[model samples]
Target: MDLPTTLAEKIAALSDGPGCYIYKDAAGIEIYVGKAKNLRRRVASYFQARDGHPAKTLRLVQETVDLQVIATDSEVEALLLENVLIKELQPRFNIKLKDDKTYPLLAITREAFPRVFCTRDRDQPEVDFFGPFGSAKELYRAYHFLMRVFRFRVCDLDLREDDPGRRSFKPCLNFHIKRCSAPCTTRVSQADYGEDIRALRAFIGGRNKGTVVSSLRERMKRAAGELRFEDAARCRDQIQAIDRLKERGRLRDYDEPAAPTIDIHAGMERLQAHLGLAAPPRVIEGFDIAHLQGTHVVASLVQFVSGVPNKDAYRRFKIRGEAGDGDPGNDDFAAMR
Candidate 1:
């Protein structure tokens, strides 16, 4: 491909590091945002033979007039940065998450004997919602798993521990089968039940599965040392459950593995060298023009600090006058100015 001297120079300056690349059109609008293990290879690949590339890739390359690169320390950091930027920028070419709206969540009711269930809407703020998960089936499966593992209350019977009628209330099948701790009959004290709740919280609070298991194992060892057999047993069971979930591949994607550290200083220095700047640029900003068939022309300005997005500094502008006049080509420069 015959490329412009300036664009070629810019591409040549790209570093060999894990990072994200932002492609922009002639109007300085970001059309696509992508990440790569090696910035030089990945971004350069886009400009190579159009014959072998996909139709989408061809179009992207054809329209790309300018680009920005943000280097990270590793592929994991690049991946995480890519996700955050994509969600924040909502670029035109990227494959987006279908459901932009919040999904159904699993909540534990804020009651004396909390009931765990799934619901679409959050009516009460006090109750804890574990997820805004991708699907109800997944959430329910998780809920059922929790039910089997924790054996907390799932019934609606309002039998208080102190109430005289509590003695008259008969044990349900759940109690007989050992599903519930039978809190109504004081089979499980409030303190013990609260410990179960704490464990459940730790399991679901976006902590890495391995980390959770390791912590549980440590707790189990400590409990054994202190001769707390019951607590030790509970911890051991939790660890086993985690192992089972791993074996079954039922541990959902809520808990993500830890990403590698991003070398912001090195990224800034490399970017500076690539851009041929006199000094390392402390802040970088991106401008994008968005429109549908020349109507409703608008601009998005995204700011970055040392190669990372500074979301708070982002701004949007509605193009007016000549730029907004439904022209064949919108004037992004005029709008930005």
Candidate 2:
């Protein structure tokens, strides 16, 4: 079928609601993707005789060679489909929130001990995820809090029960504070700690954070009543730890959303705006070296103007110093300066 000649005609023909829409340029390349609560009302506004349209929308309407709509049963379904199309087409006018952040989620392995740790990817088939939390700092804070309350192995050591030879290895630091069940050396039997892990994951992911801590507190009281002082003490300490962080407002019952960003400078313009320097530094070339103990040293630098790093002006420099060398200096004042 032939395309509509005028925006008015196309918008008038659109159905009432719940769908995804695409705006294409004359070349038939998709430039925009959008969703509508009321397709006819929304799309018609674009061609409503200019006064109702902003210059941006006007330009879009003027250049839009054709428009298309896919009807859906619900707004949420339209939203889902809109996301699908936008990702597949990578349309120019669509706002893409591109943030590739490697944040932490408490993962429980399918292993005998059911280890826990901070991980970013959702690839672990054995365990469920609790978050793409705000920051590593936040995750570490929660991690320490959890460590004080519960025991789980978080090391990267390849210690397995089937292999008895690894059992002779030195104890991990986590053993001292009771942070880890120490699967590496079999300090705690896998079956016992496995139960701890299941409860821990549930408590963290539970709708009410108090439920887990409350249950622990009850058990602690029961142990004390039963004349089991050591077990009572352990449970008491865990309750206190949970209470402390809860007071500090760091014990999150629900996870925070992930926010990720990458810094890119097309030129000094953006960098200048970023630094807020009275003026973009002259020849604002920054260089740094990356290496491990006198190995693999490389440097990167950027130029800035009007408070921006001009990417077209970016330069990469190779480092001549050893790892942990010239740049950091390990000198206090020098470090700050």
Q: Please name the candidate that would achieve the greatest TM-score relative to the true structure.
A: 1
Q: Write the per-residue lDDT of candidate 2 for residues 1-337, one digit (tens) a residue.
A: 2335665577778888667789999899888877776799888766667767677777676778888888764443344356457657877765432134464565667776565666777786867665554456555555655665676765434446676844554454456656655565645456545646755765564233467677777877887898877657766776776565423432242232232111111123344678886743445456554555544445566654333234666666545334535554333233323
Indicate the residue-level lDDT of 208 in model 1: 39
Ten contiguous residues with the weakest lDDT in model 2: 259-268
Evaluate model 2: give its lDDT.
0.58
In model 2, the Cα lDDT at residue 93 comes to 64
Model 1 misplaced stretches (Cα beyond 4 Å): 1-102, 159-170, 176-178, 208-235, 251-337
Candidate number achieving the greatest lDDT relative to the actual structure: 1
- Count of backbone collisions in candidate 1: 1
Question: lDDT of model 1 at residue 70?
Answer: 84
TM-score of 2: 0.39
Residue-level lDDT for 233 in candidate 1:
74
The alpha-carbon deviation from the true structure for residue 49 of candidate 1, after best TM-score superposition, in angstroms, is: 16
TM-score of each: 0.42, 0.39
User: Model 1, 1-337: lDDT tens per residue?
Assistant: 5776667788999998767899888888888888776789988998887799999889888888888888764443344456556656767887533234456766787776676666777676668865455446555555656655566775444545567644544444455654556665645556667666666666554333455677778878988998878667766876776666533433243232233212233346667899999987877898988877766777889886545455668899777656455433465665555
